[model samples]
Target: MHREISELIEIGRLLHSRGWLPASGGNLSVRLEDERVLITASGSHKGHLTREDFVVVNLKGEVLEGSKKPSAETELHLLVYRVFPEVKSVLHVHSINSTLISRMAQEDIRLEGYELLKAFEGIKTHETSISVPVLENSQDMEELSKRIEKKLREEKVYGFLLRSHGLYTWGKSIREAYIRLEAFEFLFECELRLMPLA
Candidate 1:
């Protein structure tokens, strides 16, 4: 929908301004009805996206509209849609906290007893905990996607991190996805700062 596209553009600008998406280092997509998706194109500056910077693709990652090529990680977005039909938006961002904490984590980063944990859907109290999965990063999207798919089947998580790369989070809508992203960033920063004490 036009509104979703506009929201994505606005989110892109907001994320870029926060330094989460720098130099075209992130990607965003919204799942549409009929197994179609509207996604950002490769190599476009996230902060300066226009209507022309988007492409429509099917669940299979085939472009149905627009001239520009989809992001290299387009398959990853498609994988999320296939795995979670309820999810309407997926966001991938590169931030210092995410990048650092992901590398520091062995298999998954665990956050517990943080009031911010309530920012995630379903968690009503800070007594709960979440384990954000960390997958090894790779340039081969297919291979990476396969690995992620396997991990997701074993663990139902709101998000995951690509080792030394970035974070991937989704929600029922773009706004929810952005909220999760922000929450994850805040949690990551808190964890990172606490690492020295640990």
Candidate 2:
């Protein structure tokens, strides 16, 4: 648990330094044994997270430990955990590229023939294509989680975007999740840069 917390804190700093998590705009979490999870607290700055900034919660989103309130999107994290039992880490970031691309996309953003696509798991070649679904953002997390759950059941994607909000990605480990997030950010940037030419 300590190791996971340290890793998440370091990851937060790295993401913040890259400007992916700005002004407390992102949340992160890691699954634990017995269906419990460690998640960042609400209103905490991701870049400056510490052990004290984390809370333990059950798979149902009920607080198990810590005094701080969990992130407002805790339900989303729980939903992912329930949907993907193998997933150990989930990351959410609000980046300029993700925010912009998600808005420009009417439904889903497609990426193909990009070498970075290899960064995602199970993709061996850039010849493959990936479609990242974009969901309408809502303050009602139950509604948002239900919508995401429904889409996930239909599409097996490595990540997704919230319209004008941000991106969410998960992995079997924290490192893998970070890698996927970085790859997604790079892909979004590349797509945005080429849009004017198209």
Best by lDDT: 2
Candidate 1: tens digits of C-alpha lDDT, residues 119-183: 89899999989989999999998889999999888976999999989999999999999999999
Q: Model 2 compared with the native: what TM-score?
A: 0.98
Clash totals for all candidate models: 0, 0
Report, for every candidate in turn, its global Cα lDDT versus the true structure. 0.93, 0.94
Colliding pairs, model 1: none
TM-score per prediction, in order, is 0.97, 0.98
For model 1 the local lDDT of residue 192 reads 89
Name every residue pair that clashes in candidate 2.
none
Off by over 4 Å in 1: none
The digit string of per-residue lDDT tens for model 2 on 62-177 reads 99999999999999999999999999999999999999999888779989999999999899999989989999999999888999999889987998899999999999999999
For candidate 2, give the lDDT of residue 179.
Answer: 94
